[model samples]
Target: MATVAGVAVEGGHWIGGERVSSPTTFDDVSPIDEKVIAEISRGGEREARAAVEAAGKAFPSWSRTSREERARLLHAIADGVEKRLDQLAIVETTDNGALLRSHLRGVMPRVAHNFRFFADWLLTLGHEDFETRGHRNHVSWDPAGVCALITPWNAPLMLATWKIAPALAAGNTVVLKPAEWTPLTASLLADITAQAGLPDGVFNVVQGYGAEAGAALVADPGVRRVSFTGSVPTARHISTAAAANLTPLSLELGGKSPLLVFADSDLDLAVDLAVEQYDNAGQVCLSAVRLLVEESVAEEFTARFVAKASALNQGDPRDLATDIGPQIHRRQFERIDGFVQRARAEGATALIGGGPNTDLGGLYYRPTLFTGVAAGSEIVNEEVFGPVLTLQTFRTEEQAVEMANSTRFGLAATLATGSEERAARVSERLVAGTVWVNCFFVRDLKAPFGGSRQSGVGREGGDWSFDFYCDLKNTVTAPWEK
Candidate 1:
């Protein structure tokens, strides 16, 4: 075990309300300084099977528990998360290399909010009943046994809870297999839920590689539902494994989302939003890394964007003044650099940063912007998932929409314009799950949040979450008089 930011890291898996170790372990490295923070258990099929069994065993009693009781337990989980907010934030920042301020102010708080919101929403959830052909039909939502939640390392804890809270609220037991790169916070969350008076075996975690443990979890017949957030290739693999049992899946995969800036839009506001692409070091799936500006204002927008990006302080994530931190791992760092190199080789011009930030060292890539990017080029159409933005100019609203929808991904898009008509019309035509008018990353927990096309398979938020976590049952009754 190793200590991160004074918090003693638990290196074993949390299974059946107890800590479980494996015969082998792997190093958990921090991207910030390239340090080995902990030795995590290397679980394979054995641990995955045990976790699924535990969840399956608990499903009977847990699913039968009253909704009010489930709601109370969910609130208690939120209380536990809030109590350990500072500790969790520090550990997460140390593990993932995200700015400490972001975890403190936004990410960690949202983790607690996820539980609280789902808990309250569960109490008010309802189904419809109607009469037709002199008969009554009743619709009910029932928990769908064990849920396999495979979350990414980008925003580990927050994203895990986004799936966990709703699954539990819907009375389904969960087995969360967090990304191998950032596994600390998920272990802590398991502890938090256990402390919150959740029943034994209701929630379990198995720490290991995706190929072994993750594959085993998804392939198990007991796992009735699977929710994954990561690369498209990984989602395809998980989908294949889950297809064995015809288990339903909710996949929130990669994105090359676009930010469309109109000439009439406020230059400063548009610039600010464009700079946000570097947030979380541009690891955010919903980040509009592709900037499609109207040709009339393309030059001005590029100048302002380049200036803002240049001024961003890339340094130690622990420092409050640091605007961005390191990529999540060395491999990710290389991947980003490769994208930049290929883009340059493909004739795109680097307006500002084009490579690693050597001054600060250690996995830090400078905030980069590329102009003259061809419409169908790999750099323009593919997801870099880094602190890199590609600029393209469009002459008309139709062209902007075409450029935005050109990518195979349709996760999210941002439209910046002054005219209300343009906002409505452009947003409607843009092929994405979420379209923000003159804004970016503003999320409402109750709203439908998931991608479209290759971006994702299903939606999950509010009732949409319940729709996936629970099985819908429709019962019809004949009229008594008949």
Candidate 2:
């Protein structure tokens, strides 16, 4: 497997069914080393205008197509993604520090399933109203024209497809700007999309920074909506831009999610679930930042949790033996380390694996677990985009819920309890978009995933995602049959 730091790519921008070299360009470096893996084209203001015009042109015809017809197109896309699974996977692995064999396999299946899932969903959405039993009330769905989908670096391809696939299924033309850090996979997605015979300008990718091409795309008057997944600060900026045009927007922002362990919860099950929540070195937006444990099991849980976290081998993401890898960059590495240092100075215990892994050449951080994390510390409050979990003990279930809801982010929360009632209770009290009971990160294509508060507005995935990317138009006949 080619390491992300070493993979060589012939960089260019994919626009309107063609890989065109841009006048403007930027270098994409692997976070592992400062080596320039590829010098990708950075779309300028002209390119952004062209992309918006193309997307706008495609929207009219694409939007009016029947849902069944749209579903067929999506199915073809899914098939195309499957056929080029190996190629796409390798590209994805090289672009992002995802495991080659494991990450590739999971994502291909996911990409394939995404198309089929959305296709099935699109098929079920009809123009006729089922709710109006005797009356002649009809419903219609129109594509939000020229949607500018700005996706993040962490899960670029998957997150882009999360919007692109559904937006396409619902007949919205897309001008996608992939994150500067991970551009290859999304660029390859443009290839597969073209291969699927998706209409020209219906799907497009422009690789550039958030401040340049990304801002241009977001602020484009031609774009009717903007869907973004990244930092909260970025989302706020996008929201401001979108508001200027009064364009609809879907924002999936940051998360400092929590996992509450009730006294009745099985410690073994909780530990098992914790591994995944903090996986990818806890770079996940849904990474359980706070581990809220009841006083009874706090010490016991900490021992097991520390042991499991410490045992994880941090190395190159390409290695199958590696459970975790370095952060995306040295900057992120320093930021995470700084947070750990501040916590320790604030009198918090570095329970285990609190520092860097000296053995790794890349920017590797240990899976840190911090105890005595007071609410005031940086580690306790801020989103440390690394493998760090702040432990907080609660004497009662109510206290657990209180601390869990303390964060401004309400993206996702988990409750591990023996009794179904306790699980339901905590799940209800916890203010989050998704509450996992017993299971963690059990994401099905059918489940809606997103946040409630500062985590950002709206949901993605499931049937609701179809609605998110499109607009609704309802027609009424005054109790008269058509």
Candidate 3:
């Protein structure tokens, strides 16, 4: 078995529309193949604070921009993103493990689509006003000053855009911080914004570890809103930091999301949709990691799922044919491998793979699935955040829901059933933020996306995102002329 390894490097930062250097530098590597990709920098506290201050300075003008004008800028950003699809995809894949072709060709198109969708929504939203009493009181949309955006490296730019597009369209200035593991895409986004001719200080990026740049941004008193996507522990830390300032926050945290596959579902379609659960090598926060299948179909489903998972090509993320890729870094690879090891010690049986590919030489792990995980085991209750899925059986819908909500996390769930009414009942009752009926990761930018419990607070996407970034203030006019 070869060990997969890569360098851990600094990819710099972008603040006030300027590509700035990180105060400290590190090496970045691929977890699958152990390749050196870039020299990353540890962002400075001074820089992070400066970025937030810049965003605060820009917020007034940005918040006051006409809805039509904001939409135009967002639409222009979409156009620029469209033009750089390949480059963005390549940069995204290099910084993260997402497949180049799929992300560039598949995921990015969706991000662009999301951009246009929100841009149009921007125009539709700011025009509406809620007036109460004879004194005309109009509620107008405005930006949350100095929104602090923190992104993980898993999907890099795709997830970043999910926040950036809407925040910009909603007329908020932003200071973004990319995960230390993958700062390349965020660094490049500075150029992307430049191409879009975004105003100075409207958007910024800072690069460093969560403890440094990220922690500083969240705690900055000048920052009025904070949006973060990462692990549960990190979310908790950010929550604590934000609480000090009563800063409005949005956290799209980790999940041990469930997939309830009833016996009535088509096996073929179920298997196909199951792919998304493990796509990106099972790194997605909203991904379904705890699979609950009816015992009757468990045998068949497990067999096929194991074969497909074990057979996936694990290689360069730039390769379209490669289905699975390396882990993000050395520490993460060890963490995932350690989790699988602990699961085995706790008596869970690996039906397919639960080990690293010693052939890769550093950070790669096999896309693995575990069966026989006891209800109380780590595999059953924890967010693995790797290419590992733990599955168990249930005899009834009620049992499935109970098992689904068994974990402390509740980010999203996928209910696979033939009955629309049954799916609805389960969907309504599931403890997750987003429920997929007979599918997984089926998202529309117009919908609210977040969690129900320990998963997160508030929501992202649609007009709700606008609400998270801004508080509505009522303006009163004494029965005046129109």
Candidate 4:
């Protein structure tokens, strides 16, 4: 078996279906122990430009390929992903510090499923037709030209494929810039795409820092569309660059989402989900950072949430028993600590777990829960992006709804109530892209997913994604004279 740290990874950019070496290389250190895991080839703006040129050259043929051919290729890629699922998952775990168990059960399966879903969807999609008095109107969806896909480190391959699969399925050539924090899995994905016989330049990866490589990809004139998943600051930068050429963009940015628990809700289930908000060490964008409980049950729910959160096992990501792993890097761990300490300074009470776990070293922070958080405190409004949760109480249904929608982010929300009517009403009232009635992080690929306000700009899954990646052309023609 090829272990993540044991394997010698070639970290070069994949361009024109070939491994392109760079003049420089950077060490990819594992967040688990800060050990140099692999030496990755580092490319800069020059490399980014070359990648876009390659993708531009390949677009015409790939776009003209038959739908059946495209679907066949996508399925083959999915099969390739499945063949080495375990190894790939291990790579992701080591690179990002997600537990191996989570990769096996959740992340890895979703990566393969994304490809399959897009491929299957292509088969069912049909062109639109309309008839008029003197003419027949038909709508044809054509692939957008070159596309730039920039994915974050927390869930690299999965998020990248959320754009890649749909872009490729729509016949658009893509150049992906995986976050510098975790580039191993993205490189591995490039290898799998090659094995599956994906044509040269259809899918390319440029691995380097976001400032140089990522900006270059987004700013390239030849790239027509950009799909990015990362911080709001970065998205704003990309938006500025993309605007130069009026490039279309799909931005899935940050979130400080809320999870509301009504008095009539299932306390046990809500408590369990409250703990899970810290999943991925709380680096998730849709993490329920603000826990809103009905005033009547606030105390009880806070106690239960704190106890369950403190009980989560944190250790080496390789251990299947480890429920929480280290942060993506040391800097992020420190940033999270600053957030916690500032919250305390701002008068928030740390109910349980507020500091780093020195026992495990690396970048591990114990799951922290806070109560008595001010309405507009830093911890309540800002995205900690760590294993931290803040609690607030609401007296009425209107207050719950208002507090839940208070943040500038509108990415996702969770509401736990026994009554279906209450669930429907509250879910509708909350301003988020996806709202869970009684569950957290339950996703349906067929549904549209993205946020409003500062959280994101466009949808990413299913038909919404297909529409984003293609240009809809309407053609009207008169019947034959005969």
TM-score for all predictions?
A: 0.99, 0.95, 0.93, 0.98
| Model 3 lDDT per residue over 59-95, tens place | 8888888888878878888888798777777666776
The lowest-lDDT stretch of 10 consecutive residues in candidate 1 is 1-10
Q: Which residues of candidate 3, in runs, are more than 4 Å off?
A: 1-11, 126-133
Per-residue lDDT, model 4, residue 314, is 89
The weakest ten consecutive residues by lDDT in model 2 span 1-10
What local distance difference test score does each model get? Answer: 0.93, 0.80, 0.80, 0.89
- Residue 16 deviation, candidate 3, in Å? 2.8
Clashes of each: 0, 0, 36, 0
Instruction: Give the distance in Å from residue 48's predicted Cα in candidate 4 to where it truly belongs.
Output: 0.6
- Name the Cα RMSD for model 1: 1.0
Best by TM-score: 1
Which candidate achieves the best lDDT against the true structure?
Answer: 1
Candidate 2, superposed: residue stretches over 4 Å from native? 1-10, 127-135, 478-482
Shift of residue 249 alpha carbon in model 1, Å = 0.2
* Sliding window of 10 residues with minimal summed lDDT for model 4: 1-10
Give RMSD to native, each candidate.
1.0, 2.4, 3.6, 1.4
Would you give me the overall lDDT of model 2? Answer: 0.80
